[model samples]
Target: MTANRFTFRRLDLQDMAQASRIHRAAFDNSLPWLKGLHTPQEDQWFYENCVFEQCEVWAAFSPDMAGIIAFKTGWIEQLYILPDFQGHGIGSALLRQAQTTFPHLQLWTFQRNIQAQQFYEKHGFIAIGKTDGSGNEEKEPDMLYEWRRAGS
Candidate 1:
C-alpha cells in the first residue's frame, strides 16, 4: 500500500488495549528473550503508564484495520505490525519518523532471532554488542544493534 493510503496517529490511552494485544502477539514468541514481557497485567500497566510517559507509539491505520508501527525514544522500544499488516511499508515509515527524534537509535534482539537481526542490518543498524538476556535467562545472549543517522 502507498503511504498516502495509510494514516498515522499518536497512540492514546484508549488505544492501549489494542496496542497491547498487537504487541503481545507480535513479539512474544518471536522474540523469546522478551517472552513474558507483556503478561496481561504488565500490558495494561504499560498502556496505562509506561507507554505514554516513557515512549512514543504511533499507529498506522487503513480503512479496515490498524496496527502499531513503531515505539521509541533514545532507543527503539518496540516495532510491531499485525500479522496481516506486515510488509506494507508501515514499519519503514514508523522508523523514519522515529529517527527524527532519536537520530541515533539502538535496540536488542535475541541472538537466535535471525530475521530481526537481518531486518535491523538491512535498515542500517549495526551489531554493536551483546548481553546475556534482558533478564530472561531462558533466552540468553541478546545482540545489541545501533544505527547512527548518516552524518552523526
Candidate 2:
C-alpha cells in the first residue's frame, strides 16, 4: 500500500482490540517467548488499562487500523504493526511520529529480534545498553536503544 494512503491519528480506548491484535501478531511472529503465551482478551486488558492509559498513542490506519505506537515522556513503550502490514512503511511512519514528539526517545527490544534491532538502528536509534532481562516480564535478553535530535 502507498504510504500516502495511510492515515495517522490519536488512538482511543475503542481501538484497543485492533491495537492488541497487531501487538500479538507482531510479537508472536517475532518473539519466540511470546508465542501463544497470552490470549487476545489478556492483551486487550493490559494494553487498554495498563499501557494506553499511561502513554500517548498514535496509530496508522489504511482506512483500517494497521499499526500503533505508544510513548510516555521520553520513552517509546511499544510499537507494533500487523504481519501483513510489515515492510509497507507503517513502522517507519510510527517511529517518525515518535521522533516528532520527543527530542530524545528510548525503547527496549528483545535481543533476539534482529529485524527490529536493525529497524531501530536505521532510524537513528543507538544501542546504549544491554540487559539480561531481569527487569522485564519475559525475562529474556534485551537491549535498550536511544535516539536524539540532531543537535540534542
Candidate 3:
C-alpha cells in the first residue's frame, strides 16, 4: 500500500484502548515473559501514566479497515506495527517521522526475533548492545539498536 492510502494521526486519550490492544498484540510472541498474560489494567495504566506523556503515538488508518496501525516513539521506546500491517512500509514511515523530531533514536528487540532485527538493520539502525530483560539468560535476550542521523 502507498503512504497516501493511510492517514497518520496523533494518539489521543480516546485511542487508549485501541493503542493498548495494538501494543499487546505486536509484542505478544516477541516477549515470552508476557505470554498468556492479559494485563489490560496494567496496559491502561502505562498508557496513561507513562506512554501518553513520554512518547508520541501515531496511528495509520485505512478507511477499509476496522483497526489502526499504531506505533509509539520515545526515549528508548519503539515503533510497533500490527502483524497484519507488517512489511508494508508502514513501520518505516512511522520511524522516519519519529526521527524528524528525535534524530538519534534507539530501540530494543528480542534477540530471537530475527525478522525485527533485520527490519531495524534495513532501516539503518545498528545493533549496539544486548541485555537479558527477562533476567533469565536462557529465556529472552534483548538486542539494543541505535540509529544516528546521516553524517552524525
Best of the candidates, TM-score: 2
lDDT of each: 0.75, 0.90, 0.70
Best of the candidates, lDDT: 2
- Lowest lDDT 10-residue stretch of candidate 3: 64-73
Off by over 4 Å in 3: 29-33, 64-76, 134-139
TM for every model, in the order presented, reads 0.83, 0.95, 0.82
Model 1, residue pairs in steric clash: none
- How are the candidates ranked when ordered by lDDT, highest leading? 2, 1, 3
Please, what are the lDDT tens digits per residue for candidate 3 over residues 1-152? 76567778877877767777777777784655666565877877777667777777777777522223333443446466677777677777777777776668778778888988998899888999988767643457888888878875
**Which window of 10 residues has the lowest lDDT sum in candidate 1?**
64-73
Cα lDDT tens digits for candidate 2, 1-152: 86677999998898888888888888898886679888899999988998889998889998888889999889999999888889999999988888988899999998999999999999999999999999988888999999999988
State how far residue 58 of model 1 sits from its true place (Å).
Answer: 0.8
What candidate 2 gets wrong by more than 4 Å, as runs, is none
Residue 89 shift from truth in candidate 3, angstroms: 1.2
At residue 12, candidate 1 shows an lDDT of: 78
> What would the C-alpha RMSD of candidate 3 be, to one decimal place?
3.3
